[model samples]
Target: MEISAATMDDALHKALGKIIKSKKAISLDSTKGSNRELVGVQIRISDPRARFSRAISRSQLFSSLGELFWYWGGSNRLDQISYYVKNYRQESEDGLTVPSAYGPRLFALRGKNQIDGIVNLLREKPTTRRAVIQLYDAEDLDSALSPPCTCTLQFLMRQGKLNLFVSMRSNDILFGFPHDVFAFTMIQEIISRRTGVELGEYIHSVGSLHLYANQQSKAQNYLAEGYQEKVPMPAMPEEDPSAAMLVLVRYEREVRLNQTLPAFPCGLADYWLDLARLLAIYKCYKKKDRETIEKLKNKMSASVYEQAISKRAGQIKWQTIRQEPLNFTSQD
Candidate 1:
């Protein structure tokens, strides 16, 4: 079945509603876990930029950013990703790296840069259908662990806009769907900037779109919360965003390492600077320093991130208070 929506939340709500009620869905058990699986699902997001959802149940913004930077950096190390989402350690084979991580495949598969190749291909011929990035390799079958769920990403330039079509072998709707949309659509925007075109629709095709038994309750909670406003992220500057992206990546590494925040005048636009400040905010959150988090948050220019950042700050404050020792000897 196909679902078309204007934003990620809209699409997610529609897809979840269908999965919960569709008689065609089957209960299945796999090596991963038990889930209700639906085959051949296609979701098209009309506004690719409105990728984020304000669903409090999911709390996906932080982890989504982590996944995006992880993939963009072409990293497979477990330590790097586990810091953002602890559950990623479960996917690691040797407790060191995740072979199925798409970073290595997307950026450097057999020393061939598929991202660059796609950019070059599209720049040469806007209408070409060969601008494909292959993620699932033949050797993945030999591995003991599961292969990448995302098999391929195809980009098409039409009507002065760049569109992305993605095919996934499997998808955990409640878990994987949101992050995949955020990252892939960001890539689409990046490619559009590089190719000098407007951002277009995102088509996600999944062979198996399933919601695990463990996440069913959370999914229902998301649905119960009802509709949220569609807030699109800031547009990438018309100029080539590669340099700013590199700066963001570099600052991200520093922030993840708990290093000092880079000084201002780092030569990034306000758009990129706001993103860099978010990493700083995340750093402060990791340190459990609510004071610095608030300070960094105040510096952020993007209001789209305010809710998520505020929520995170509140969590850190609560955690700090909970961890503090309380004295009750006098009362006792």
Candidate 2:
């Protein structure tokens, strides 16, 4: 079944109902329940730019941001992924690194700066269908611990706006969907702003869209307690993603090292920098490094700070973030 909605939350809400109500469940493992599965679920969000979902944990939102930046830096840090996900990262026979890392492939797949190549392509030929980012490196499936869930991303410009179509081979609707939308749409916004186009529709086509039977209650709980979505997608800075790559990499490094927030201002735009700091705060949150969260909190944009910390009112994690939080009172 297909679902289309104005926002990701509505699409997910409907998609969850579709799977939960489906009788065509996966073959049961007595050890684990037959998680309901639905094939070929197409979710099209009218505004790819309206990606902020209040229901997602600050941890989930920022971790996805971290992963995207990690990939942007051309990283293959299975060690870092292992620490966050608690053991989903795969290693090669050498036991050193993930064989088919998406970051390296996306940024350095064709030697260096494929992102620049893509930006250039869009500028040179606005209507070109060849503007595709190949994430599925087929060669890795045989050896890599995890092949990419997302196979490719195609960018198109229509009526003066840039739209995106992401093809996913598999999508865990509950756990993975929200994170994927946030990260990819942020990338989408970056490209749109840099290319000087309006943010348009985001169509996500999944081969296997599913809900884990184990997390059924959690899904329902989220549905029952809805979130306040940030509508009308925000516009990112016109800063060249290529020029900003070096600075973005540096900020990530500083955050990972648990160093002091550099006294010198970052070279990134305020929007991008605030996003990065959210991820940094999340890392500190995981470490329960309250001092660091507090430090980074002070540097963050109050609008994003409140969005990251204050929503999902009763969620236990946000309770601490609420103490003397940044004043982004206008959540509209």
Candidate 3:
């Protein structure tokens, strides 16, 4: 299923609302020191795209869905979730498995022909089955080298019904929490079709769902935008592994550019538009944080402008202008 930006925004809104309504604010321990918050929500939708993008982005530590799936997934990290949207086959052990908390485990299904393989697996084993992908590697976590995510998702098929259970250890309520729902649901949809099962409920169990004080105002603004009107899910594309690679290359370029010249003097909106165009051409993911981008752009531009003005003034006064414009009058 194709998940669009609007769909993601709606899912986030619903999740935030639930947390607020339940009056269950996440607790923060002073030891962590990271000013992050976590919020959780459960969504039931037929669309698979929404779920896929949400999961990968949250897991991969990227705010953009396209970037997460295309770039991070292509990097071959076993602890991260693997997606076979076009097929249902399990991944081969070969070189794909990585060392994790649960020993070396295959996080996602992998096969030569994903679609065909999944169909075959379902046909042969028509029982309640699960595809488990984990993010927290105990070794990595204990060594303090694990990524910021501590989440796992399980897709279960029982009696021709598909259900998703997401377990999160620490959620960034402001940014990361909402996207989780969308990602898992997408996985559930893909598994259901390959196995010919009906879509079921989504159960999200969050451990820490605090709202960061800094992001409180932004969260409120998002809430004011109101819930999105429900729409039909988009069509899923055929399985293409190359597409994932393309996503990674594009995202790498974006990260490099952003980090290298973060203070480039340019118009805020114009800069983002340029970046967006570059991403589209390279088939990378784009996000909807224009406000943040704009603010950064303006800061960059102001800094450049100040430097240029200072240099120009110095050049005119010290280098360009001499003591005086001497007039050699023919001895009048």
Candidate 4:
């Protein structure tokens, strides 16, 4: 379920065609320095997973509003948003501790109640459907620090394939378009997995996709170089029992880390301490080379020893050790 850059280019080309045929006059915004003008078609693609569908819809131009809010709004401590949207609320009860103020604006736009919307959608439509959540709130745009998007997203389900269509008011071809391509595609993959649907085409309809005056050189360079038409998608997981085991192992490790880490610690020192311990264990298990493992072990042991000696040192808590057999494959 990986997306290729060529697929992205093809979608962009299709969007350009739509815009040209429509004969729309796209406004170019250059308020920001460095000639950031809107150009090119805006498109979205989606599958079943509601959060994933929403992510694919918005990730194209700007990292999904959820992403912006998560990173900027200090809500990354837990996967509350993802859990809520995915209907795993029982498993994510810990997330209820997150303040309502931290919720992203898009959540409301999706529905009055995020969890209910997702659950109802899932129950009624067990099959994969193209579900979209939008964030261009008129009230927010009018009073906000930033302007809302002129274009809106529509998710379509056709023949069990999820397709995304974005109608953008403005497009900054050089700067903004690439983000839209990668983010939406990733969203496509996540939804595909959750809903058991194949990702089809991403349709973009751009009103104005332009390069700013200052970006002429950069645009020229891009035009001259031409985009590489094909990029390889990551290999899909194999269906063999052994392959399943590997995926399970990875998931288990992720769960362990998730459960143990404190809800987003404050600063670098705290982050480093946790990271050091995690890396040490991960490196020990993943690194096959004895030499590499030994080196990591020595470094980690020294760091732990130093911390123990420090006057500011607090309680050193270590979890019980569980060893799993390692299985290697050419894919690894």
Clashes (backbone N, CA, C under 3 Å), per candidate, total 0, 1, 19, 9
lDDT of 1 at 237: 87
Candidate ranking (TM-score, best to worst): 1, 2, 3, 4
User: What's the lDDT for all of these models?
Assistant: 0.85, 0.69, 0.42, 0.38
Q: In candidate 1, residue 280 scores what lDDT? A: 70
- Window of ten residues with lowest summed lDDT in model 2: 323-332
What value of lDDT does candidate 4 attain over all alpha carbons? 0.38
Query: What C-alpha lDDT, on a 0 to 100 scale, does residue 249 get in candidate 1?
Result: 71
Runs with alpha carbons beyond 4 Å of true place in candidate 2? 23-33, 56-59, 90-95, 110-112, 231-233, 291-299, 302-307, 310-332
lDDT of 2 by residue, 203-307 (tens): 999987877778888888877766446454346666656556557666666656653343323456776667666756665565555554655667765454455
Better of 2 and 4 by TM-score: 2
Q: lDDT winner between 2 and 3, please give it.
A: 2
User: Which structure among the candidates has the greatest TM-score?
Assistant: 1
Clashing pairs in 2: 71-103
Q: Give the clash count for model 2.
A: 1
**After TM-score superposition, what is the CA distance of residue 323 in candidate 4 from its true location, in Å?**
33
RMSD of each: 5.9, 5.3, 15.4, 14.4
The residue ranges of model 4 lying beyond 4 angstroms of the native Cα positions read: 1-6, 10-30, 33-103, 106-123, 126-130, 235-332
Candidate topping lDDT: 1
Q: Estimate each model's TM-score.
A: 0.93, 0.82, 0.50, 0.46
